[model samples]
Target: MTLETGAPENGPIMLDHDFFRDPHPVYREIKKNGNKPTEVILKTGMAYIPPGLKAWLVTSYEDIESVLRDPRFAKSIADAMPLFAANAPARQEGGGPGRSSLLYDNMANNDPPKHTRLRKPLNGIFTSRAVAPKRADIERAAAETLDAVAAAHRGRDGFDLVQDFAFPFSIAVICDTLGVPVQDRAAFNSWVQTITGAAGPEELARDAGRMAAYLRDLLRAKRTGTEDDVLSLLARSLDEDEAVAQAYALLAAGYETTANLIVTGFLTLEADPQQKRRLWSDPALVPGAVEEMLRHQSPFNLSLYRYVTETTVLNGVELPAGAIVFLAFAAANRDDRRFARPDEFAIEEPRREHLAFGGGIHNCIGKHLARLEAEVAFGMLIQRCPELSVLAPPAADAWKVSPTFRGLRNLRVGPVPGISETGRAHD
Candidate 1:
């Protein structure tokens, strides 16, 4: 497979707004190139990565798995510092070429030893057994959020599922676990939005700093207090900066991704009536359905920046050290090699393993909790509001404009034809 670089004859595929809205077509096109690592440019004005950053994109399931599992493709951001230092635009004020907030000092960006050490403090907190007891609370939260939506939109045709149900419910679960006060959620979300949104480095740095400070204060409170939440555990187990970083990491990583899973999963099911019927027909299928939805419309479109630790040839393409690489989890989940009829959202596909939560060591630590949350949230929704249906296709503005994450900004929903608001079918 040939690697296209620097304005190839056909030009590098632009990850523009359209690509953000519907990337599968491009994913298919990329796969047509023999599933090799294709060079893609992160265009100007995107979130996460710096503008004009050229990263090798791996989409095939096997190739993505290789990058994710291979030690050669490292997560240590320091390995790519010189690359960023040369390519990134000069930052104003508190921001610089490679400057980022301390919140990023967590394990996700580190290589082993440091990564292993930083990951240990909060390792067991999100396991299925750990999160099982919280199911009742999660269900109640989901129920209450839906109830509020119904009340606010009384006699109306619709309410935004993303804003009314998914976002608040998901964030609340993570925040409550971290012992963040209910009143502080709004400001906390604002800071997180700015940090994760398509803002310049200066804005990202500022908001990230704010979030880091907030986490530090919360860690301090948890240290002296009797709360038995995740933050409290972190405070006790790690030093101040590391504890604060981990707390921010949990909040940042947990909330929006889970929220996206819910919205995107629902949308995917709605678009496929057969799967929707299957899900409602078999309540026992909820867990498997969650996996299918995760595979079908992965919350995270791409993996975090994995720097090439050293020169290595992957899929016949030679990747030099310090090159930025991204494993396209969303694309890999739908690769036909690993999954039969991969595009179809089949809960009974038999192959339950997908790269949605990633693979290898740095796989999501909160995988169990995320699954539990989605299961409880979707289970409650299916049981309580089976009549709910999207009123219209999401507008262009509805898709969040982020290079790293894929989710709706809003999704309007209400009872569908032949189904009453009480969830009973009409005669």
Candidate 2:
């Protein structure tokens, strides 16, 4: 379905199911309008904003980067809450606010110096240098997860990659990094799903509060515990609420996005068998391949809503004060101006700046760790499970329902001839 460029007479363009499953074509259509911003609305429950609310969708690399870097575009959730409150559709019974306070309180949703202050303690920890030491742990976790997947489905038709491998594996690593107890780890999947899913206000509130309480308890435990995880570090430095909020952001950010990256990365390889073969032939290309995966199919379709603090011109378009803007990273990464043959997934393509992890001060802090994890994930899959392939064509409802995030609901694979519990192909 073609995306209409101008403002619709009825309302903002309603994003259809096709748009969620495959957004590149829609993005291409939007970018065709001389790279101008278009007003659009996400499907109900698919966005952090109220569904059917009109928002500016910035499609071009130049415009998105400009918005990300410009202080005129505020990142604070408080700035955007009034807009949601005014424009939000009537909530169901017992639904007070559209979003929980826990979501709005974090560094990701705040402008500096609040954003600066909150991110300061985290800056040193997530850098490439600091994250390098965790490579061994990431690899071990990936291998173990793969082993379980192979063993469970050795003779079965197929097994879900997301449920059996990617989601659990990614959550395990993040939980370990955060020092969440093994018993408490199981609750995270349910908590994160409700918080991020297209759930009602009460469900969102309940999950957010539960996760917040869990983080608070974990932080309290870390005060006297001997663990050296991220939570322990935050426990010593920040107060209870501040630390819990940051921890919540970390958990939310580090969990689904990374898991989706792994699943999508494999999907990219499956689509381009030559690329998969190239990686298997030469493991050295894994890192660059991971970057290409990020660019070709970024895990996030758009950046979080940035409110216009004052009237400003972005990409020759005037956006009034309090206007809501969403930077379409998936769209910008596919802009032909920035990367030649942007639609194709090619590892050998020359390096270029892509907005996959976003840009500017509010950019993703866990980017280095994310890249490292993807590299390990792709490398291990190629080196060990060379015979692996997607079992059948992905189902019509394969993609997750979130408007902002892109990930598979489940990916089936296997019915291996000779796969061992070790996850190695035994011919």
Candidate 3:
């Protein structure tokens, strides 16, 4: 159903269910229709202008950037309760505190002064100065995981990259950084899987409560004991309730996105051998490669929903106060106006601004860490596993299922001849 538009219509559009499932086609369609700023209102009442929110999908890069950085647009999901209620399912029992983390909840979710206060402590912890010491540990863990994968293959033909390499590598690094016990890693992995799965709102709520309780117990233990981990640091720095929020935020922010990056990076490299070869030859290129990967395969396609605190005009489209906006970072990253050859993946593309980590006060706090991890992980993988190739037949069907994160559920890899079992450089 199309919205009644008093404004002039400039293009043809289709409202199809597939649009939600795979929006690239729809985006292509929108782009093919020309550059005129027209609107396609969805049956769900979300408008797609071009590259913005699904509901109000703004197509223009400038418009999306404007809305993203604008103070008038509310960053908190709570602010858009009515809009979410209309589109998303109702909340389930035991959903616990809705806003959980300083990054995801009160601070990142809130606007202006409150956000600033909430983020200050976290900003201190995640800055380059603070996180620098952890780099060696991160690299070591990634190397060890790759070593294990190499060992497991043991001159074998193939192994699942996601399971054997990427998943373990990312999980181990995050668990180590957070100081979560190695013994508890399995349980935490299970919890994260349940929490992130395609469950109903009620299921998610229940999972959130369980996870929160688990974190609370961990925080209590850290406070009472003599340990020096992130949890302990947080316990010392924050109040009990705030500690819970921090723990929850770390779990939510750290795992899913990193896992996606690992899987997507591998897959993208496998698809483009030349690019992979270039990266393998020059390890220093990993940093730039990570940025290109982020631009090419944005893990968080949908923007965290924001509410309009005051009336705003996004790309000349007047949005009333209380309007819910989903800043489509995935779409904006591919905006032809801002990006040359927006559809193609070019690692050397001039370092133009991309919203992969988002923008404004609510940008990802773990951005540096995420980039570092991906760069190290992928850089090592290509260099160490020279014979790595897709085990599955080359077909689009080989891709995995996940709406929020785009990555392989199972990416099989074949080892190169002469590579050692421990992923060490072989003669």
Model 1, residue 46: distance off in Å is 6.1
Q: Which residue runs of candidate 2 sit more than 4 Å off their true CA positions?
A: 1-11, 46-48, 96-100, 350-352, 415-427
The true-versus-predicted C-alpha distance at residue 74 of model 2, in Å, is 0.2
lDDT of 1 at 88: 51
lDDT of candidates 1 onward, in order: 0.78, 0.78, 0.65
Residue pairs in steric clash, candidate 1?
none
Give the alpha carbon lDDT tens digit for every residue of 1-427 in model 1: 5643423248666777777777899889877777778777776433335777777788888888777668888775555556654545543455532333567677887878889998887778777788899988988777667766666677777788888888899888998887889998988988877776677777777777677777878789889999888888889988998897788878978988999999998998899888788888777888988888888888986778888778878887777787788888889988888887888778766357788988888889998889999999888888877777888989987787677778888898876122234432211
Q: Report how far off residue 355 is in candidate 2 (Å).
A: 1.0
- Tell me the number of clashing residue pairs for each predicted model: 0, 0, 13
Measured by TM-score, how close is model 3 to the native structure? 0.82
Candidate 2 matches the true fold with a TM-score of 0.92
Better of 2 and 3 by TM-score: 2
Range of the 10 consecutive residues with the lowest summed lDDT in candidate 1: 418-427
Candidate number achieving the greatest TM-score relative to the actual structure: 2
Write one digit per residue (lDDT tens) for candidate 2, span 1-427: 3334455346566676677778877787666667777777776553246666667888888888778778888877666778765555654576543334654578888888888888888889889999999999999888877777767667677678789888888888888877887787778888887766667777777877778777888899997888888899888878777888888889888978999998888888888988778787888988888888888889996678887878877666677787778888988888888878888889877244888888888789999999988888877777667778898767868886676778888888764333444556532
